[model samples]
Target: MMRVGAVAAMLRAGAAVSLSEPELLGLAEHVRPGAVCFDIGAAYGMYTYPLARLAGPAGQVHSFEPLPVPYRILEAGWRAIGARNVRVTNAALSSSTGYQRLRLPYRFGLPIHGWAHLEEGLKHPGSSAAARIVEVPVYTVDRVCELRELPRVDFIKMDVEGYEAEVLKGAEWTIEQHRPALLLEIEDRHLGKYGRDSAEVAGSLLARGYRMHVWHRGRWNRADRVSTRWRNYLFVSWAAERRR
Candidate 1:
């Protein structure tokens, strides 16, 4: 989940603004011109715009955001920039394609659109409560890739709350074939909502020869173990690792 303040700041910064944070700047190092990138759980087009800029006019950027409010904002931001390389999808990506209840959690009487998720039957921390439940269509990355006829996928940045594992499950074909670099947000608490853990998520990728790297001190540091504190991690294939 994203922070409300951060999301707001990014939206105010506009699509043309350049990224300054080290972690965001680091993504530019991995993405090359003509790269095909996916920004899953793109709240307000924070990473989507930068990815579109990095991919350039020749490349394609697919951004997914299930929530209606943010989806509209994401769409508006994309249009505001008049970018032709980006495609905004108003759907969530999971293991199966269907409709699911998207929880819009609220705190202090304000909806925390940033923490909105698809996990049902889980208690949120603080005063976070579901302000609304909406049925949003879901799709698998493989299905979308097949439908869109994507020649190749160079990179994927996913932050679908606790459903990261489920998304990976559906994206197996894309992962195996393209071996694209994956930047994922995995938190133990969030995973608990779906009866999952970080290891279960990382295990599947590691088994497929994807090495985990933590962003630290303005660089990607390879790690055999997941960071106990940080939730964001970059996973790359053995071939990409060799290139690095």
Candidate 2:
């Protein structure tokens, strides 16, 4: 579970490490030397670890992940980096503060593996690779903020497969409270997975006073990630505007 070198390589390769942080190309312009960052759906701490480095000793980074395997991987990976400012939480975010079964998108080229297109929506519940269910505690961004007992967050990076909309919904209070900038990944196929569409996710961001923009599209040459070839939508607001 602890794939230290593997995951660390990912961070070094330019993973966001936090949604609030910009992608590699725009990182220097968007990120500050000491800013708090929240990484949602942190698979292996790829984004969280580097974020700690960016935040330096004064900044803080937090990762929220519900998938058990990935969560453990993240724990060990972050430990390897020795970023004391980083914190990892094994919790999923949804529209409300409760439970939800997160279906893993099929692994590429696994013969019997479900089609990777299930990001479009799971045609069957039993197609999961684990072949067994994994229950992960779920939370709202608001709940996370409350539990952390913090006021005013600097940034929030969110990529919860197809649940981006739901995650944003649960973070309503956090959005209104901190007004953190957002870098959200949106896949039409993944949106369909949760019986929704990317437009809905985009609409949610639009309503939150964010100046919306598409950073880039995730076009993989191979069937790499479950979210293969989805567009990544990034949102940022000027400090003065964010305060509004």
lDDT of 2 by residue, 17-49 (tens): 443323633433444667778898887665676
**CA RMSD per model (angstroms):** 5.2, 7.0
Backbone clash total, candidate 1: 0
CA displacement after TM-score superposition, residue 215 of candidate 1 (Å): 1.1
Candidate 2: 10-residue stretch with minimal lDDT: 111-120
Top-lDDT candidate index: 1
lDDT (Cα, 0-100) at 61 in candidate 1: 92
By summed lDDT, the worst window of 10 consecutive residues in model 1 runs over: 1-10
TM-score (all chains, Cα) for each model: 0.88, 0.74
